[model samples]
Target: MFFVDTVEVPGLGNRSYLAGGRTAAVVIDPPRDIDRVIAAAAQRGVRISHVVETHVHNDYVSGGHELARITGAAYVVPAAAPVSYERLAVTDGDVLPVDAGIALRAVATPGHTPHHTAYVLEEGGEAVAVFTGGSLLIGTVGRPDLVEPRLTAALARAQHASAHRLAAELPDRTAVLPTHGFGSLCAAGAVPTDASGEPTTIGEQAAVNEALVKDVDTFVADLLAGLDDIPAYYAHMGPLNSGGATPVDLTPPAVADADEIAARLAAGEWVVDLRSRVAFAAGHVAGSYNIEAGEGPGGQLALLLAWLIPWGKPVTLLAESPEQLAKAQRELVRVGIDRPAAAATGTPEEWVRDGERPATLARAVFADLVELPASAILLDVRRATERASAGYVEGSRHIPLHELRSRIREIPLGVPVWVHCAGGLRASLAASLLASAGHEVVAIDDSFDNAPFVNTPAADRC
Candidate 1:
């Protein structure tokens, strides 16, 4: 009588679920955009009877409060979670009746947060699925360092215990549906999967999840060691989620013209180009940063822009068309980049100021940089882990993209910079930033695999 439907917010790499029997359903870990959850409930032919949260989210705002209000569903939150709203406070072993022979049983599973809970969906007293929100994930566990630095170590230990506890108590076949695993920053490390590469289970986790397979000490050490930079925007998500984040305002911002666009840039506000990296690299308005807009495997606009730009910086968007602008706006709001201050949609030529030419940037593959020039600076902008995982060239300067804005001055004014990331996406971002800063840049529009090719003379594998 019950079914589970995943509502994936691919941009942020999180999932909300709408699952229940024939006539009623419950939503877990919904995104800031509640309409998708509402639509899922309607499509399931069930009314939302309960809206549940496993924890106060740190990645995106929760739609649970508003969804419950809209549907008159019972709002369920973990007991003692620091939420400002009223909710059905459920603790370990608490059961919420769903339908005939169907129910959700809450199990206290901290580590992701002090009050994090995982819900076990049961049919006829048998575990059907476990919604492991930011806890035990596919091949890893929720990162424990999102909380205060002082609590990270303790939380890492607790994360290990929580995974073991879930594995020990639940039936091995119980489906493990985690909110953070499919590219979510909340996940600590890479996710390993079987040939199928699908959602995991308790049985599968025991072999692949470090938290379940390794001893607590080893898992904690490895997890802590693998921790990377957290998204800067996460600082606001927890407070907004707990304090009842309002519905996202994705209504299009007032459009801007070339004059306004130039003025915003001159005033030190961000005017991001939401075009393809190649399109951006070919030509764009002077000082406008390039964060290409798309939501596939290569789409890094939302994450990269929110990470690089100073929080609450006034933003103006430049896109090739209205459709591209709309999509980019939605992506921004998913990460709490609510309303853009102003926006413009047109070709790069349309955005150029009077007496100014559309600026052009150069792009090259790794092979093009074989013989280092005395006049050029080689910059590597990928995270430390990526550089470590994939080895670096001999003389490349290392400054990760996230830290590049504040550290821009370290690179001299007149020298030309040749920048590259693991792939071309981040290098394009770095290239644009360097251009805006008055330094000539060439984006290494090739994969890092080709870097080793340039070791001796020229031309290696891409």
Candidate 2:
């Protein structure tokens, strides 16, 4: 009998798969940290026979090459993916046997990337499951714009065709396993769960996926309309994945004392506090940005820090414990932020220098906005798409959270800056950023849905 197992990287909103007969298996689209994949194989009593990548991913670095090297397995890549590594370059219709009756068949499904491919797994000469990767996600498809601005329109059309092709060719019961759309920015639109809380099959996809239901023209238009800003860090990911990205080093980073922390902060380096938003607001070393690293499945540390921080700047991670620091390291590596220049663990009391008090902020809800003086400047740091759809206070100035650091100069100084996002997490991060920049700040730690002006003229919006 054969079984398929998932290795989920919740932080990145992606899944790697291990599937095989009792004695052997193949790993599909693994994350940079391969230890989880190895442990998963060990638990199932299977020796890995192959490591495969569906595309040169733009969301995270691939662990395929390193996983294959460690297991002495054949690494498989799409025929058109340009890479320096030696691999079995698969074309459409090539079948890779996985011992006994299980095997993987390649199908060209390029849209997420120019060379993207999907793999169909068959048992006893019948298709059972297909790894759709970014091409065909849960309810939406991978955004085609990540590759190049010029190629976006064409790729959107291609994505529509690819989704239809898979639905047409596969049986109703064929399981559809995708790599994105589970809260990953790679998705072209919002993802919707089925009655089972998953878009589990080709039949389910046909019933709801826009690419399957709409004509190619309508699908492309709808997709382009819903596209969000690409994460700034995504530009580095494709090349890292395709150009032989080195395996990550997970050893604890060098410990930073208060002196080194102060030095780094003085030199304009990033000193990120990885504690919870609540704890971080109560107290933290002066000038440190709070990202709250251990947000689990819903965390945005990898996306936010990589997008907002000045690229390639040295970073020092500070957390409440050694374990949290290590977990944050793992999350960073998945997105190709390979190393933390230094790290520190302990409370704000331990992080701050002698004769200095820990920095603190006021965490307020939307109700508190009415109490602020008219001179208070409301800063909405949500994505443009969110502001357009969800509405915002009329006079608030806009700066996306990703662009806030670089655009800090544009925001007027010496004013009470009340910052907000769709939800509070980003606002907390933005609040810390504005505070670090010497502005008096308050984080609106409440949902936008709860805003008093949501339906009034104050929030009448696109």
- Which regions of candidate 1 deviate over 4 angstroms? 192-197, 453-462
Against the true structure, whose lDDT is highest? Answer: 2
Top TM-score hit: 2
Pairs of residues at least 3 apart in sequence or in different chains that clash in candidate 1: none
| TM-score for predicted model 2 compared with the true structure | 0.96
Can you write out model 2's per-residue Cα lDDT over 1-462, one digit (the tens) per residue? 778888777667788899999889999999999999999999999999989899999888898888899899999999899898899999999999997999999999988988999999999979899999999998789999998899999999889988989999999999998877667888887774221244389998889888998988888998999899998889898888878779889999999988899999999999999998888889999899988786345588988988887779999999888899989999999888889999999988877789888989988898887897798988899998888777777678899998888899887888899999988889999999999889999999888887766533344534
Alpha-carbon lDDT, every model: 0.87, 0.88
lDDT of 1 by residue, 76-109 (tens): 9998899888999999999998878889999999
Question: Over the full model, what C-alpha lDDT does candidate 2 score relative to the true structure?
Answer: 0.88
